[model samples]
Target: MAEETHVLDRPPEGANADWTIPQHWDRYTAEEHATWDTLFARQAKLLPGRASNAWLKGLDVLKLDKPGIPDFEALSDRLMKLTGWQVVAVPGLVPDDVFFDHMANRRFVAGNFIRRPDQLDYLQEPDVFHDVFGHVPMLADPVFADYLAAYGRGGQRALGLDALQYLGRLYWYTVEFGLIAEPEGLRIYGAGIVSSFSESRFALEDPSPNRIAFDMARVMRTEYRIDDFQQNYFVIPSFEELLRQTVETDFAPLYAEMKARADIPVAEIVPGDTVLTHGTQDHARSRAAG
Candidate 1:
């Protein structure tokens, strides 16, 4: 009922910035590993045909079944073989620049804490459960891997443009919470959607949110909700396609244009929208009233 509390810079369960002591992988409690297993098992069960093949393949390549908090050194060894990307530990959400720097260098900063079992379905900030479980698997894919690094570089430029609102939308619509249309139907690829139980279902089956075809410009100008299920989901045709389009086209000029225009609210249906499902948005409205 109240505004979702913000707790930035809170280090994960056993993290410290010394970066010298090597990640004390042996320090994660047994209960903590069980938490990762629980979340991993739950989402693995739910994802089947729902998530993209790249994400699924990533899960296998990462060998995530070894359990407990993954030893970053081991995971990094395997990950480098797949996409040359490595995961590092972080406090919580770092400043935009720090996050972008890590991403640009192909180093993903994951929170060291696992979510409390009770917080499985949701958490205020990204924890190990959300960061590794949600994002690591997809990083194994080469093309999507490149896209993320590029986005990180782009983040730096976008910050300078005073267009973070638009740039953040780019991340919201694609990286964190997005879907891609497969030959069979819409499939989940975005880490944010795949990691949350409620959103996993809401994104694909619920009619409350609009499903629009992915449009770079339209998405950069859109707004998204951070605390709840998104009011809209942008669908891409394929990860490779999604990456090619974004990496090849420079967003510098695009950001310049977006800065001059009004940012679209979460649920608005615009004329140029490549609308897939035009919802009455009853679900979001009902929640608001309650």
Candidate 2:
């Protein structure tokens, strides 16, 4: 199983606050570029036909072909023309507020470093492999681009309403590890799954996790595990629909309602769930039994 890392809701220091403000773009070593290529080559081989059209299309449009670690300045120029979105380098996971603030303003953060080859299967903090390669291409999509920005705007509201947990679930199910139903079959769109080879396969083919419909309230109430493959994977009817429902809906009322309620456990199945595959909990139990 791939390991997980959960970032806090607030910045631990001033570092996360201004990561979007770029400086010193010419500092990468040749070894760093090699690292990006190594990771990129591995994921590329694994994702064909399994990843969404939007993801593949965006990858092509962005010209991820230049090789090595992408130069943010050069990459941002092309991305900015397409969606007004630009990737910024962060040291690691930023405070939740720092993350939200960046997203709210059309800025996408990526870890500035690449993962070591041995850590390729999993790492505690997001690296450039998990950031730029996993996330930037999707920002090129108009619908997903907007949905992310809206989620960022909703972040502060979630904090005030004490509904961050609720909103966080929406993020977990959608942005980080969500799936989309394509006419051909299920496709990968979430950054978390896309970046890792094992989870990419496990998320789609394994019977260990519940594949449920995306419900804003239900996702919020439900808890997620960062340490293992997710117990549940939310499936959207389509990437277009996923973006439409989330970006267009007003979350203020929803947050207010969730604030007074208790969170749902990862194991409970909710009603009205469009259950694609119900898990027996045997996969989860084996871990506990260990």
Candidate 3:
């Protein structure tokens, strides 16, 4: 994994309170662009059979298949026309509130740098490739686009209620690692899975992780681990349904209830779960043993 060099919820010195910086599209070197090409080629090869139709369609619509690192201005032009969403540059991770504010405005904050070639297989911080390739494509799907905007709005509200943790898990399961039930089979849509070549396969084919139907309350009450493949993946029936659940429901009451309840462990398969796949958990056990 790439070293965890990111500044956590705090903005670095001289950064604007929101922690945004220029992408300096002109500054990328030939080596950096080449890194992007290599990673792009690797992911594009695997995505067609494994990714959601919407995600594939979005890739074409956004013209992400063309070549080397995409110019942010050029990318934003096309994205703005499709969904009013645009990519913005950031140094690294931003404060939660700043992140929510950007997303609320339909702006996605991406790291300006690309990982070195040696770091291709893993990176602790999100790079331009992960941000744009993994995430921007989904923004082209209108239903998902609307859902993101709603999630951003919800993030702002969660802040006032002191419930950001509850809301953050929703984003983790749905946006970062969510699966979808397509007519053909379950397909990957979550950006985290889409970005990682190994995870792209592991998330779908591995029987070591539980695949459960999306449950709003359960997702909110669950914890996530950042250092490894997720132990459980939540599958949504459709983007429309996911959007409806998040947009139509008020979360204030839900937050209060969640605070009164204990959190679910990351690897536990609780009762009442709509289990899609009962994982053997061998992968997690093997990792622990190592």
Q: Best candidate, TM-score-wise? A: 3
Please state the error at residue 192 of candidate 2 in Å.
Answer: 0.0
lDDT of 3 by residue, 1-290 (tens): 12436656676666676787777888888888889999999999998889999999999998998878998889989999999999988888888788889998999888878899998999888888999999999999889999998999999999899999999899999999999999999999999999999999999999899999999999999999999999999999999999999988879999999999999998789988999999999999999999
Candidate 1 lDDT over 1-290, as tens digits, reads: 01223255543344445221245577777777888888888888988888888788888889886667788888889899988999987655677877788899999887766777677777878887778878999899998999999889888887787878787888888888989888888988888998988888889998889999999999988888887788889999888888888788778888888878888898899998889998779988998998
lDDT of 1 at 164: 80
List TM-score per model, in order.
0.92, 0.90, 0.96
Over 1-290, each residue of candidate 2 has an lDDT whose tens digit, in order, gives 01223354543344435644342446666766777788888899999878888888889999986787787888889999999998887766776777788899898988766666678788878877788888888999988998899889989667677767778889888888989888889999999999888999988988888988887678877899999888899888876687777777778877777767777788678767879889877779998898
* Worst 10 contiguous positions by lDDT, candidate 2: 1-10
Best by lDDT: 3
Which lDDT value does model 3 have at 124? Answer: 82
lDDT scores in order: 0.82, 0.80, 0.91
**Ordered list by TM-score, greatest first:** 3, 1, 2
Better of 1 and 3 by lDDT: 3
Clashing pairs in model 3?
A: none
